[model samples]
Structure formats: structure tokens, C-alpha cells
Target: MAEEEKPFICFKNGWNMKIEPRNRKGWLYLSLWMLALLPIVFTFTWLMNRELSTAQSAAFITGFTLVMIGWGFAMSRWMKVRSEVIDMNLMIDFMREREAQKKRGRR
Candidate 1:
């Protein structure tokens, strides 16, 4: 019964609040994000490697990294909002199914 249920993201049991995708939907989102980011990252790296001096490259990379981090955080939050809705609905469905199974098992 448990094997049939699948979720986009699974909650990790730990002190750190980390969430990861467990199914194809999650993988798709991650893959798309990586695809979107790859070109920009490559462009930055290429430009910095060839055009910037050592100190300049360091500064550019630092700034770029910080901006990318901020962008990533925002994207994650947006994605989380969508996934959480799906997760909540799935949880409700799972609970309902479990209850139905229990009632059947009793008969």
C-alpha cells in the first residue's frame, strides 16, 4: 500500500529543515532549473576567465555567486509554495485512503 504512494518532495526527519523531490516531477523541475542556470553560469565563467584580471575575476565571481544564491532562494520558495499545495492534498488523500483500508480490514 505504501509503495503506491509517491510524492514530489519528501520531508527529511532531522534538525535541519531540508526538502528534496522523490519523484519524476521533482526531478523535472530540478533538471529544468539546471538547464536554465547552466548557460548563464557558463557564460559568466567564460567571460571571467578570459576578460577579467585575477582580482576582478574574484570580485565578479563573488558578486555573481551572491546574486545566484538569492535567485536560487527565491525560485526555491516559489517552487515550494506550489509543491506544498500538492503535498498537502496528497497527504489528505493518503489519510483518507488509510482510513478506508482500515475500515475494510475490520470487515
Candidate 2:
């Protein structure tokens, strides 16, 4: 069965926008990379606490996990915003090219 296509929702003025399918793949890859950092963060925290006392090591690991989780969320949001900007720029360039083509056609 074919899946229905969903339109991208724009926050300002409740506009419905369409993004190229190829651009969506970029977003998926970005999200995957962000998720992949979780295990790495866990391993790093565990490795860093090996020399500390049991209680101290537990505290350090807990603190590190919280900090890493917060950092990951922040970085994910930043990357998403950056990708949106790139998509917007590409859209603008495409529109300009289309207008130029229309003008050339009328000549």
C-alpha cells in the first residue's frame, strides 16, 4: 500500500509547506547521528569514573549522564534549526531560478 504524503507545517501564519523528499532524508540522517551518541556518552562516562571511589564513581556517572543528555537535546535542536535554514535557502534559490526561467521564456 502507498503511504499518504504529509505537508510540512509552517509555524508562522499556519501555512502548509512542501519540502523535497530528498531533503527529508537529510533530516532522518541527522536524527540518527544524534541518537547514536547515547551509547558513546554512556561508555565515556563509565570509563572516566573507573579510578574513583564507588560512591564517587556512581555520583560522577549520574551527573555525567544528565549533562550529556541535556547536551544531546540541545545539539539536536540546533542541528534541526540549522537544517531548516539550509532548506529555506535552497527553496529561495529554486524560486529565483524558476522566476528567471519564466522571464527567459517570455523573451
Candidate 3:
């Protein structure tokens, strides 16, 4: 069964502490995900400078860029999915409120 929820966004709701990511939303996660991958760039440069042969440097950097880019794309998709869930939750609340009002009017 779905759990009952108190009013959202108010400090009174116990969920306020846990649902914080939904409050700030996507920009933060996207930025953090990108920042998280940035260390890979430096690590790649270090490896190219130290371990890889001159001929391998270009290929290594290219592959690393491609992998990080792919990871960023996946993260973008993940953020979108999470945002959609938040939207759906809001939509369901609105619909349920409307239904409750209709029921009250009939009584």
C-alpha cells in the first residue's frame, strides 16, 4: 500500500530531510557528476606522461574522453529519470486532492 504523506516542502514533514535532493533538483546532481569525472582527466594525463608510450598517448586520451562523455550522458539520463519521478509524485498529489474535494462536495 502507498504510504500516507504529510504536506510537502514544509519543515513539519519528516520527509523534508530525506527529500532534499528533489528540493534543489537536477542542476546540483549534474554539476556534481561532471565534477566527479574531472579527476579522470588529470589521471589520464599523468598516465600518458608516465606509463604510456608516445604512440599510445593520443589513443589513451581519446578513449578516456569517450568513456567520460558516455558516463556524463548516462548521468544526464539518470537525472532526468529522477526528475520525472518527482513530477509524477506531484501530479499524483494534485489528482488525489482534486478527487478528495469532489467527494466532499457530494457529501
Candidate 4:
């Protein structure tokens, strides 16, 4: 039997999805560090006009991964879902076009 088709918006179904959400759990750890550090580093220096310290400038680096939390999974999931939907739609259109051409040829 053919595989059942997934719902169009179901990223959790993992059909044609490059990475599972389970595989990316480590990102949460990274994001935690980032969330803690970004505010301390950027707030006093860039936003507040505080002078940069060799250490303050460097403190920002540790939080880089945490800041990524807001975007990473959401963006990757969006991209994967979009790519699969586009591909499925393209396949459907191509098959319809082929069928139309075959009917025309028969006339």
C-alpha cells in the first residue's frame, strides 16, 4: 500500500523534513546561555552607550547561542514545511499537465 499522505501543515509528521525536533534538543542548552548573556553585554555597551571593556565586549560572545533560540527552530521548521509544500504542489501540477498533454495527443 502507498504511504499515507501527511497533512499539508504537519511538520511533526517528518515527511521530507530534514531534521526532527528531537534531534535539536541541544539548542535549548545553547539558547539558555545566550539569553542570560546578551542583555548584560549589549545593554550596557551598545544600547546604553557604556564604554566597551575587553571583557564586556567579550561577554557578548557567550550568549550568542541563546539569542538564536527565538529564531532557530521556528525558522527551520517553517522552511522545511514550505519546501515540502512547494514540492508537492509542483508535482501535482506537473502530473496534471502531463495528463492534459496526453489527452490532447489522443485527439
Highest TM-score: which candidate? 1
**Residue 99 of model 3: what lDDT?**
100
lDDT of model 3 at position 101: 98
Cα lDDT tens digits, model 2, 1-107, are: 99543322222212333332235755575567668777777777677757777888777678777977887677545444443323455677799999999999999
Please rank every candidate by lDDT, starting with the best.
1, 3, 2, 4
Lowest lDDT 10-residue stretch of candidate 4:
5-14
Per-residue lDDT of model 4, residues 33-79, tens digit only? 45866665565456336566777656665455455565566655554
What tens-digit string does per-residue lDDT give for candidate 1 at 35-104? 8888778878777768667898888888889979987897677566544333455567799999999999
- Which residue segments of model 4 deviate by more than 4 Å? 1-48, 75-84, 88-107
TM-score of candidate 1 versus the correct structure, residues matched by position: 0.57
Comparing 1 and 4 by lDDT, which wins?
Answer: 1
Best by lDDT: 1
If scored against the real structure, what TM-score would every candidate get? 0.57, 0.34, 0.45, 0.31
Off by over 4 Å in 1: 1-7, 10-15, 85-107
Better of 1 and 2 by TM-score: 1
Q: Report RMSD (Å) for each prediction in the order shown.
A: 8.1, 11.0, 10.1, 9.6
Give the true-structure RMSD of model 4. 9.6
Which residue pairs show backbone clashes in model 3? none
lDDT for residue 56 in candidate 3, whole number 0-100: 90
lDDT of 3 at 44: 83
Error of 2 at 8 (Å): 9.8
